[model samples]
Target: MSFIGIDLGTSSVKAVLVDDRQRVLATAARELTITRPAPLWSEQAPADWVAATLETLRRLKDTAPEAFRRCAGIGLSGQMHGAVLLDARDEPLRPCILWNDGRATAECAEIETGEPASRAITGNIAMPGFTAPKLLWVRKHEPDIFRRTRKVLLPKAYLRLVLTGDAIEEMSDASGTLWLDTGRRDWSDRMLAATGLDRSHMPALVEGSQAAGRMRPELARELGFDAPPLFAGGAGDNAAGAVGLGAVDPGSSFLSLGTSGVLWRTTAGFEPRAGSAVHAFCHALPGRWHQMSVHLSAAASLSWWSSMSGQSEAALLGELGGQIDRPSPVIFTPYLSGERTPHNDPQLRAGFLGLGHDTDRKAMTRAVLEGVAFAFRDGKEALEDGTSPIGEAMAIGGGARSDTWLAILADVLNLPLRRYRQAEAGAAFGAARLARLACTGESPEAVCAPPSGEADIFRPHPDRAAAYAERHALWRRAAEVSHALR
Candidate 1:
């Protein structure tokens, strides 16, 4: 049988069809837009998600009709921490408050003050990007909507509601809401109360590899399926990507260089280092957890530079070739959208230091690349403190396409970086694996095995590593300066 995996990303909705042997049969995608009504506020209409998902599925089906018809299970992965508030009739109360929205910064403190055990309970510091804080922001500013709110669902759960008419959530995504008692993998009564909400506002929880519900009959027929397919309780985008890479065992790690950068390492149990802004959340599979360091801008910094310079990302990097001989004379801080890991300061902004008369676009490009690598190094240090070392990491995401960047990252972090076959498939491919496990009742080890082909490895050069070590220290000092400026 074939399985379908759908990912609801910030920029687009993507679907992939995979056969029983875990080979991707077909792929499709539909772009999505974000609305910024005010500064630091991001929103997206719930209807738009539904529309994009349906269109993407249709496109996937068209590409491989036979495989699509034999689909046995459907798995979902989506952007985490979005608050999709629903009313009595289960209709969205307003556009979803996105994960990157910073409008609820003040509410984060309110939660910590109201729930003294919040950090201990949620295993995280109060962050405006979490769902609970967004709800608190709404309660204080948009009281009428808050009063009308009946249920809160993460982005994928909202899509799950539309597909199955069930309000079910899985562990990995729910762990980001700041409502779950992450250690126990369940909703926290105290956490909900602190935000003036309760258990009723939460959905039934399930493990990511379990079956949540079957698709609605009408929806199934509309999608051209012969039967209502079993829906697997999938995962948050990061965790889903881990499953796709088979980084499920403790100490197994990967770094994602998407619009945002993340250094993720799987663990055997809950490990919270909230003081360092490290996110300790449940993994996609049972009995596993993960710690991650996030930098809000990774490839995004390159995107911004590309737009400003009127040059494509590929063109800008092409000028530098596959590697750089030494660190750029100029140092850059990639705080374009503020930062998260190691420094949860959203007010921090990016800057370039030591610009000379000879500083050209190529130098700036190299500095941008090195800046992001330095940020990952910061994350690596934070996770390494008082925990097992991350000896090596697999690289994934759009930025992983850059061999030069990967080489730079290897030198900066001083850890080998591996790029696996089919790395481009990412979270959607992992979601398909989760669907396979749920449908076949197979072990995660068997279903979520890493790709079979030999991986391309990026090793650090000794001389460059020593040079970057000194530059990284200077970069840390510069980051401290940025913090002071903020």
Candidate 2:
């Protein structure tokens, strides 16, 4: 039998077909646009996501008809924390307020100040990226839509409702909404009261692997097959990525370098970090939790550098390789999009300190790489304080494709970095693995055999590690100065 896994990302929706033995047969992808109507506001039509998902599946069916027909189950993973409101008739009330949209900062502050009360309900402080704050934004600015709302679902849950006629949310995705009790794994009545939203408007909470419902017969027929068993409840992207990296056990961690970067580790039980340096949320794995620290501008910073200089990434890396004659004295702060971990300071701006005419493009490139590594190190230190010590981390994502950057991360983090083979394929593969386990009664471990590929392991150089320690102190001071100015 075969299984299908879909990753509904911010920029695109990707579908992968895999057999019971965990071998991928074929893949399909469709990109969607994120519409920005104003500054600090990002939105996307829910209909766009639905259309893209259907087109992707149709393309997959044409490419692998046999695999598509033999598919026994389907799984979904999606971007986290977007708020989608629907009217009483299940029609979208407005474009979804995306995760990166910071228009709800004022509302977030209000909820944060409401503190102990907010904590009592959601087990999390209010943040602009969460659903509750976006809901409040609607109530204050677009009260008409808020008034007509019958339910609020995150991005993937909204798509699932359209596909399967089920209005249920997985715990992993719900935990990011600031409307769920992280400790209890359920909707927070206190939060509902605080947000002035009735609990009835929320979907029922289900475990990530639970079967929410089967695919609608019409949807199945449209794709040229009978309705397949659909696993409505899956996970947020980060949680799904964690499963992809096999970070299901305590102390196992992964570093992701996508448009944003993150350092995440899985744990057996819920453990919220004090002061909110790291976000603690439910994992896709049952009865487990994960802690994550995010850097809003990780790979994006590198991409920006390439675009500004009109140089390809490989060419830039080659130039930087020639500059290894000596360590560059420049320090960069990777806060172009604001920071999420350790600092949690959204007002801070990116900067290049200690720059001189002598500082060549190589030095600038090296600084960009080092800056992201420093941010990751900060997160790793915070997670260490709250949970088990991180001895090593598996590197995945577009940035991990660079050996030079991986070496920088290893040196900065002072740990061994292991690059997984299917770095970019993490979430979709993990979703497929989850579906296989759910359908065939196979253990996740049994299904995810050790990846077979050459892995470059970077060990920390003691001298480089010491150099980074000293530079990190200066970076922190510079960041504080920048924050104060803002």
Query: Which candidate leads in lDDT?
Result: 1
In model 1, which runs have C-alpha deviations exceeding 4 angstroms?
A: none
119-210, model 2: which lDDT tens digit per residue? 54554556777889998899999999999999999999988898889898888999888888887898888777677887899998887766
Count the clashes in each prediction.
0, 0
TM-score of each: 0.98, 0.94
Determine which window of 10 residues in candidate 1 has minimal summed lDDT.
446-455
- List, residue by residue over 420-463, the lDDT tens digit for candidate 1: 87868999999999999899999999888776788889999999
Q: What residue runs in model 2 are displaced by over 4 Å at the alpha carbon?
A: 322-327, 448-454
lDDT at position 41, candidate 1: 85
Worst 10 residues of 2 by lDDT: 319-328
Best by TM-score: 1
lDDT of each: 0.92, 0.80
Q: After superposition, how far is residue 19 of candidate 2 from its true place, in Å?
A: 0.6
